[model samples]
Target: MDPDRVPRVRDMRVRVLRATTSSRARGPLLCIGTVALIIAVILGAWVRPAPGTTDTPAAKSHALSVAWPSQGQASALVEGLGDSGDLGNKGPQEPVPIASITKVMTAYVILRDHPLRAGQRGPGITIDRTAADESFSGVESSVPVREGQRLSERQVLELMLIPSGNNIARMLARWDAGSQEAFVRKMNRAARDLGMRHTVYTGASGLEETTVSTSSDQLKLARRVMRDATFRSIVAKPSTTVPGVPGTIRNTNTLLGTAGVIGLKTGSSTPAGGALMWAATAPDGNGNDRLILGVVLHQHADTNPRQGSQAALSNSRALIEAVREWLSTITSGTG
Candidate 1:
């Protein structure tokens, strides 16, 4: 297949189905998404850091310039468990509805306040009637939970991040702080601390139109997420057994095991469209390893359920593949 002719997400929305451990678009922007994606990847290898991350030597000594989608945004940021700056970014920096990608910040706040060791289920919170009743509300995705169920923090995190349980996000928020309002306040403070000036949090879940951000801001959050061992392990899972879910609650991110995509989050809605924040490790031209974090926001998709997530993922895959190609050039001595 031609690198510049990657396919679009036309018929992949089944992957985002709301599940009891169960179910699951081809578009015209194929060429642009492919070509522009490669530019971000190659530039990702050499572009300077933005603010919080360390800088790296530019690989080819050219400025990053790519024509991205007019209706959406995309970026390939420097990836490291260590703090990184920036690599290459395309599209508008304006804050847009990010949907459930808001959960990334939710998870980050939890991890920051209550650090967890790998494999150790942190504090357990008993699921009350209110939590259970709220779990299956409205149109947002959710997992099974009983009113009286007791679950560990890891399990809640898994359900919230994997299946995008909006109720679970609130549960975590309430547990972390005393009330949802207080937790959201914490979220905004964390955003400011991280230099996410354009980012704001109206709720722990991205279901609110008020919960918004840009691709660039999300890339910053993703960089922080990749460094956390617990978050990394959970996001990489295609599926895991949750305490309340009878069937395994699988990951919504279909790209998990492919193309070095380890772990991340996916979100979609009528207003927020589809969005994704992803990370992977690939070698640059120097045969040295580089972590590449990519984000695609406001991607075009069908109105059906997670159709936006489907579209976001399809584009995300193209971007990751482009980054992989960029890395292969280094190992192949062509870089």
Candidate 2:
């Protein structure tokens, strides 16, 4: 049980060799016999170690001293796209409502069913009456699109992701799978395929309180979805002008461009609180890039969506900066 004692075995071996050498004056035969006996005992105790003993160095645990969100679950990973390792976790592992981060899977499934290349428009989707009505109702974040108005598939994704539009998400869901109920099946299936075991997708837009997931589960989905070039391009945008939508719709993820953040998603609601699935890149201190992925959920729950979102954004920014600083300290050994 005491690893400290393991090193003493080598010291004992050195002493035994010295004893054998000094005893050569007695006789070669006796010295050899005595040395063999001592060596056998040492080898039996040290080389053939007991059940729980090990001579190998213990693996060091890399735990970050992050000031995590005051409430809800938070988990982060480093080098997710490469040789990945978990940095740490905070709060419980149980699943809870994820708000609009559900759209990440919605986008993932749509992309898998209909692939898009760089600069490709993919297909045209007509705005439906429900989506149009939701836009004007002021119930949730949305981009205005008239019913029967046609927009490119790429533009729809831009609106859904950047602005965190619930209606746009449903429109895309219905357009792809004929109904939100069926589309949710695809979302859950995609979650299962991606190894998100703690996740459950009950709706395409994540407006349903039943669409619950853990922070760790969302991080897994974050890594997989970020691989798509088109998906990455859409989430990173700060703002975009979509056809059939008024003005320039902006991304709710304000953490973009801070701490080398590139693209990901943000979700919030009265029940889900503020949740964000975020990605960023920084130097690994070895002249190569490292990808950082993280998720924070359930900040300021039961509050208004705007307040929840603000809390999520603020907490996430602090986490990003702290992670970057941790990396810098590791590389420089100055922490």
Candidate 3:
């Protein structure tokens, strides 16, 4: 062969060998990379956190925190009183309107601000024309306060709460603070002081749409109210007749008849629907006292205040029973 041709042949062979080696090396690398990518995808799908989960430490801590009991869980604050199913099969924080239950707060605030002597009359309040016109006239469930009548602060409060009188709420709000707006502000401030963050007061009668509260907040308020001996007595009073009212007014709380039933409030409005706050005290197996504050809000069936209160009373009774049973079982080692 010629020298030039031989050199060219050698160069071509070298190039071919290099290309073969490169192909051989590239094949394994490509295969390995593909395998690695597939493994990564499979692992990612299998091991990843489910949706709505937070991977951060703080979120993880929150996830591990305790949660409220679900609806129908059998647990009682007091043992040996009744079973879990007795009061009502309901969650602790179900939102209900709590109708006249709002009065419990009004009474509490008044009592806190002014300490009245036992049998001492409340501050005298002249009935406003508006209050008188709207006062429980022809209302089956009101303590009648005449248009021109002058009523003691305590008397008006009793009428407001005991009979769930709308007029009394209005009158008291206007009487104590000079205006309903001022009284509402005081009520909201009091609620905030008690750590009822979810509560807002726009009306003394719970008639306004702006006046709102959650079940949890109301329960907290009820707990505080029940702690007061005087407040408890006032709420538990079955019947009280005012001197000026035409007919005797009875307490609207139906739980008064239930065993171990203490005192609480009930409320209802066109906007709020139906709501209730209640506390029950029952003896445990060892005769220890157990107290529970329950609240319910927004039942579909209770359109009227009267019907709503009835439903709440029935539901509360069932819940109390369920809680009692749960507690009894816990003490008996059968829970």
Candidate 4:
């Protein structure tokens, strides 16, 4: 074309051609945008998460199991008001000698006849010549009381349960039922009432071989006694002061400060061996109670009392750890 003269009329068609090309390019772009919108809608509708989804895991097979030692004539039991319960026992549930666990019964009877209210010091128990005689170490593990020193009933029960005071056991028996012989009769009757069929309480203290019980029977006694607020309160203390005494009487339970052990009793003798009626409790994350009530009876009976006590404590702690481990695995499992 001839420079400026021929192209004047053709310039408008060039503008139209440019406009057509732009419209043609927009068609593919609109199609691409529509496809992307459809894909996004499909993904939004189909790729959603399932209901109740979370990072937390779930539990499967709530049933729990444990393993324990086969030595000693002992039994370890853990039970609560929940689905979890466990036990580890060696030897038959046959009648075996129960040493100072007998004090649990003595406290039971005294509390049964004369209940100690929560935080109440209770009525005074005078330390007569007979009670004062408990200080004389005829048998091992005796706590002395002055002839005129007066203590509350709760304090006497504390002496009976904490330091394993044999004389206090006798004195409390006499005070409750008028005689140690009579109180023992009540003890047997109460055992029957509480369904401790395997137990017999011949003496106010577990010093006599005639006073015998099975581990299961002691567990039953523990369950019943743990329900009492007064007994529970007295046993939980690590140590307490007598009203007129200068020194504080400490609990003989070596496991008191650990394993969540609150209270119970310890028994040891040449006849009854080393026995411990123990109660353990711990709170879960939600603050629910988990109780492990058990009896380690006649542990290492042939061994000396010191060695037997160590064995009893070791066995009890092992059982507690086993329970905690089993619970951990169950709760942390993925369903």
Candidate 5:
């Protein structure tokens, strides 16, 4: 039946009641009947339901079921270029120690303070004895360099991000903001500006175990960093040759090039477990490319760096492939 016609039917009933009423009571009854009809018309207009419909699902039950790693927290964004929002997340959203993934922020802050462009090496930073000496420490990741040797800002960033160099991170922090302590304040401020309320930065290098963030928070950083061409080019390299470093330095993120993963950073320690902030590109089955940004944190917690890092790499690669496969199925109408 037409919903619009229901209001008219009720109006007709009220009029018929008024005609049958006694004259003395007619006036008062007619007022009430008129008010009732107006209310019915208002309600019918307000609750305008579709002409003809039944309760049913709008689309197939193609809900994606991801096999998230049993350990750690993970979040991802898969969408076309310039699109916002993420593909939702798996595991907890609470902040956790993010290991060297902290360096991504270090690089970000440096680039913000001293911007670098493609093919342009920025200012040169002299290696201080402190940074040089820390390179020999067996406890954290570092690359040896002689005191007083100078490297450009671009080269220093390459060292810090590609090799996950803790000392390089400190050096850049000190160079950019006078000291590591001062630089950490900038990091925390940057986090706040980025809307990462759950994140905290206690050190320039994430070695302190106090430097913490969530996978979702790091994903926010991931999107911002990829916008920088310099950061994008540096992190995407699987290996690079740097002056003063023996042989060649390689990226800590072993997942590079796997499942279309292009570039990002990885972090691991006994306290922070293993963490990765990664970016990739894949076809969205709609003739457009989708940029996929993801973060996995606290994989294999309390384990050594090697074990933790391996776990992060393995899990992230699997997650990337799974997302791509799911997108394809949905596009084919078989999800």
Candidate 6:
């Protein structure tokens, strides 16, 4: 309790505090220096090559030809077509109505879940009044099926896809899964499964605004469809008759008989404009086969049916040529 003793005690405390602070500061500096040294060692190790390093050989030689005209505008993958064509504007992602190319998906879903063997009968589907009525009198095309008539599931599928028949699509949607709503759910699910990242299905008939696809997405669908022998056969047939329809339904794909053309689908509506998804096969001089799938959307701005068809044909031809040329370059070791 003496005043002199109190001063002495405070002085000792101040000295102890300063020593503690200095030690703490020095500790941090030591830690920082240690970290810096560790980092420097790591950098030195990374920058040095191994003691036995030899010059790496040049990358395996590749044959050079003109680059495929991707132009960063049109994304193209050429496996066999020769070089020398503009694959066209890849452009910004556009949302175009796919029209009946929707059936390509419909067929894909059915084939994946329920494949049909040659000469095999599919499940029988009764023609509901709604299905028949829609098919017989829908705004778009139809394969005439009277109410109460029944057709094999395979027959309905053929009708739906071959002629892009709306009625058969509705009936098959009803028959296969009990309702078009249910079928569309499956369609969308199939799209997801197939990596159709930008696809959405609003209806079984592409007539509905709900049914939509992009050209890129459609080319994906066409690639899948081409793998199925049954689908390929049906789509390739230029004309076929369903028992109930009064007249034979001709294939709507205009390029069916065109050179190097195989089979695909054509779609058009007032809103969807004109759309076509096509596949072509060209010989690669070697034993290899060249396959090209191309999609054109909104080919015509006007609503005239004839004009729309002409636009579709012209656009499709251009796409086919581009694909063919790309394939040629790839096979020739020029692309």
**lDDT top scorer:** 2
Instruction: Select the stronger candidate by lDDT from 3 and 6.
Output: 6
lDDT tens per residue, model 5, 172-272: 88888898899999999999999999999998889987888888788888888899999999999999987887888888878888888898898899988
lDDT of 4: 0.73
> In model 1, which regions exceed 4 Å deviation?
1-70, 80-85, 301-305, 331-335
Q: After superposition, how far is residue 307 of candidate 3 from its true place, in Å?
A: 3.6
Residue-level lDDT of model 6, residues 1-335, one tens digit each, is 33435555565556555555655667877656655565555455454534322211111112322222221111222333433222323534455666777888888888787888777767777878886667656368887778888777677777887778887776667766888899999999989988888789987878775576666677667767788888887888888877777787888887887857777888777666677777778654454677766676665533754566567766667656745554544445543
The alpha-carbon deviation from the true structure for residue 41 of candidate 1, after best TM-score superposition, in angstroms, is: 31
Q: Residues 1-335, candidate 3, lDDT per residue (tens digit)?
A: 33434554555556555555655667977656655565555455455644322221221222222122232111122323344312322243323344566777778777777656666776777777877677646732345566778877677777777778777786777767888889989999999998988677777776555566666576667767666666776777777877778776777777775856776667665545555666777654554567765665654333675565565566667666554443433333321
Write the residue-wise lDDT of candidate 2 on 145-183 in tens digits: 898998889988998999988999999999999999999
lDDT tens per residue, model 4, 204-320: 978788899988778888889988999998888888877665588888787886877887788887666678888887654345556777787777786688777777777777766
Q: Candidate 4: lDDT of 154?
A: 81
Clashing pairs in 4: none
Residue runs of model 5 more than 4 Å from their true location after superposition: 1-62, 81-85, 329-335
Runs in model 6 deviating more than 4 A are: 1-89, 329-335
lDDT of each residue in 282-319, candidate 1, tens digit only: 77666678777888898873364467777788878877
Provide TM-scores for the models.
Answer: 0.76, 0.78, 0.67, 0.75, 0.78, 0.71
TM-score of 6: 0.71
lDDT of each: 0.74, 0.82, 0.61, 0.73, 0.81, 0.66
State each model's C-alpha RMSD to the native: 17.2, 9.4, 15.6, 23.1, 11.1, 16.3
> Residue 195 lDDT in model 1?
83
lDDT over C-alpha atoms for residue 249 of model 3: 79
